[model samples]
Every structure is written in structure tokens, then in C-alpha cells.
Target: MLYQDHTSVVCKKQIFHTEFILRCHYYITTFDLYYTDQIQQTT
Candidate 1:
């Protein structure tokens, strides 16, 4: 029972980390695209 609980906690932690990384990546990509578009328009 203790092992199962520990495993569950680890799984949750992994999922949270994965989600955080994905969100950060998405925001960076979106910002880069927006900046690029603005630059193109100005030029």
C-alpha cells in the first residue's frame, strides 16, 4: 500500500512537470511568432 501511494505521487509529480514545461514552451513559441510578425509588418 505504501509503495502504491509513493508511485502515485511520483506519477503526479511527473505529470505536473511535463505540463509546466509544455506551457512554457507554448508561451515562448507564441511570443516569438508574434514578435516576428510585428517585425515583418514594420519592415
Candidate 2:
């Protein structure tokens, strides 16, 4: 849960601060993404 929160926060900050959010769209599945925190995965 904590790691997920951190990833989310980082994701938000990355978009707010830099151009690193573009390459994130190639993620077809949540499991395949860079912020791949499986502890909070949903069905």
C-alpha cells in the first residue's frame, strides 16, 4: 500500500515537473507499467 502511494505521488510529480510521463503510455496493462506496484492490484 505504501509503495503504491509513493508510486502514485511520484507519477503525479513527474507529470507536474518533467517530460517523463509520455513513455508511460505504452503500458498496455497496469502490471506492465513502470509504476508496477502489484500490492494494490485489482481484478
The digit string of per-residue lDDT tens for model 2 on 1-43 reads 9999999999989787655455455444554663566544752
lDDT tens readout by residue for model 1, 1-43: 9999999999999999999999999999999999999999999
Error of 2 at 25 (Å): 22
TM-score of each: 0.90, 0.40
**Winning model by TM-score:** 1
Summed over model 1, clashes come to 0
Residue 39 of model 2 has an lDDT of 44
Backbone clash pairs for candidate 1 read none
Candidate 1 residue 23 Cα shift, in angstroms, is 0.7
